[model samples]
Structures are given as C-alpha cells and as structure tokens.
Target: MAAWFLYREGHLFPCYFYQTTGFYCLGCGGSRAVLALMHGNFTDALRYNAFVILLLPFLAYFLLSMLIETICGRRILRRPKLPGWAWICFALVAAAFTILRNLPFMPRL
Candidate 1:
C-alpha cells in the first residue's frame, strides 16, 4: 500500500530525520519531489532531488509486485533470487551513480 499511502498523504508524514538532525540529509527533498512528480513537474522533482525522482517508479513497481504476490501468487512469475554477481553489480552501479551525482563534471548524471 505504499503508493496509496503516498498518494493519500504525500506531505503529511513528519520527518523525524530532520527534526533530530537539524540538517537536511540525502532524503530531505523527497516529499516535495513526489509532490512535483504528481503535479506533472518531472524537472522540478529532479531539481528537488534526482535520487527521489529516480527511485519512485522502482519503488512503486516493487511494492505493487510484492502486494500482488501476497494477494495472488500464481498470476505472476516467481521472482528469481538475485545472485552474488548481481549484488556486486548493483553496488558498483550505486557507487558510481553516487560519485557521479556529487562530482562537478557530470552535473546531471
């Protein structure tokens, strides 16, 4: 129900992270990012935080798939386990993305 929850209460949730830290972290702009995306403002969402913009669809699909499996398992193909190589690949990809995003060269990577 993550999508529904987000849809219903996009900005209603209080962020304990900011309240406790007194500084915005990597996930700080996520709510506004979601709001911007919902408002048909992809550019604004990316400007607010590219990570959030990039993560939403993946998260939505993941949640939906999980819900479908829990509710009606046979209709969908069984998800295969991710291999060790796959984990390594994902980690490398994430690290590369993080570094690129922070670097001065690739401003929009």
Candidate 2:
C-alpha cells in the first residue's frame, strides 16, 4: 500500500531535517528506497539509500520473528539480544552513512 501510494503520488513526504539543515538525515531517501525495492530495482534502491537496503533484512527478520512469536506463542527463530556495544556500532554506522551520503564526492542518495 505504501509502495502504491509512492508510485501514485511520487513522494510521500519531505524530510523536515533535510529541509531545515540542508543535510540528509539517516532516514533520507528511505521511502524512495522502499518503493524501488518493491519494484525489484535493487540497484536503484541501493542508490536511493544504501543504509536502508543493508538494514532491511535485519528489520524484516526482527519484525517477522516478533509476529511469529506473538501468533504461535513460541519463537520460530532464536531472538538474538544485541549487546550495548552492538547498538553503539549500529548508531555509529548510521551516522557515518548519513554523513557520507551528504558528501559532495558521493553520489546523491
């Protein structure tokens, strides 16, 4: 449904952070990336937002695991508990991606 809306409407919403700061946020181009992925355009999706592309699998796994556990009253897969350092690393990666995507030398995300 979201992909359909994006297909019909072009863009879902402007990134207020980017608009105000003239800098791409971590979520910049995320919607377009999703739309591109839905259309089976892997390269375009990655170009739109490499961070989102790379993270989607983990996000999908987490959500699917949660849903499965909720519905079945047991986990189909073991839920891996991320340590504090892992979260910090993830945050650092996000910050780096945000900065890199906005760099003049980098391709537009």
Candidate 3:
C-alpha cells in the first residue's frame, strides 16, 4: 500500500497535524520518502525523512526474522532482551525527534 501511495500521480491526503497546528510532524515527509525510495532515490528518500532511513535496517531485520519464524512454525527468531530503560530512552528520543522536526529551521520536505 505504501509503495503505491503515489502511483499514477493521484491526489495525496492532507496531513491533519500540519493543517491544525501549522507545523510539520516527524512523519510529514513520509509519503515523499516512500515515493522516493520506490524510485530508487536513496539520497532523496533520506532527505525527505532521515528517521525513516535510520530505522529501515531495523525494520527490515525484524520483518525478515518474523517471516523466517513464521515459515518454520517455530520460535527461530529471538529478539535480544532490552532493559526497561532502553524502551524509555527510545520513547524519549522519538518525542525529541518529533519536536525537533517541527522547528522552523528544520526542512520539512
């Protein structure tokens, strides 16, 4: 669905966050990023959403691991144990990124 979000140059749905707050959210450029990635424009994709680029590897790994586990019908993919604090830290970082990405100086493209 994401890969084809922009197929055939159809209209894009407006982002309610930006419409209401007049500020860009961390996911403001996600559509553009996906489109760019589909077109094989790595640099453009990162320019559109650096956070997406940063998380791509982890997402791919997790997806792959899940697929393998599903295919084997067993617990073959074991995720490393993360301390509670690690999750908290991740939440904090995500919140910070959301705030920082909304700044006027940050490129919302």
Specify the highest-TM-score model's number. Answer: 2
**Weakest ten-residue segment in model 2 by summed lDDT:** 1-10
lDDT by candidate, in order shown:
0.69, 0.88, 0.77
Error of 3 at 44 (Å): 1.6
> How do the residues 30-99 of candidate 3 rate in per-residue lDDT, one tens digit apiece?
7777677777898998888778777878888888888998899876877677899999998898788888
C-alpha RMSD for every candidate: 4.5, 1.8, 2.5
Clashing pairs in 2: none
Give residue 47's error in model 3 in angstroms.
1.7
Better of 1 and 2 by lDDT: 2
Stretches of model 1 off by over 4 angstroms after superposition:
1-10, 75-80, 83-109
How far does residue 88 in candidate 3 sit from its true spot (Å)? 1.8
Ranking by TM-score: 2, 3, 1
List clashing residue pairs in candidate 1.
none
- List where candidate 2 sits over 4 angstroms from the true fold: 1-4
Kindly list the per-residue Cα lDDT of model 1 for residues 5-32, writing each as its tens digit.
7667777466687689554445666777
Please identify which of the two predictions, 2 or 3, would achieve the higher TM-score against the true structure.
2
Off by over 4 Å in 3: 5-13
Position 62, candidate 3: lDDT? 88
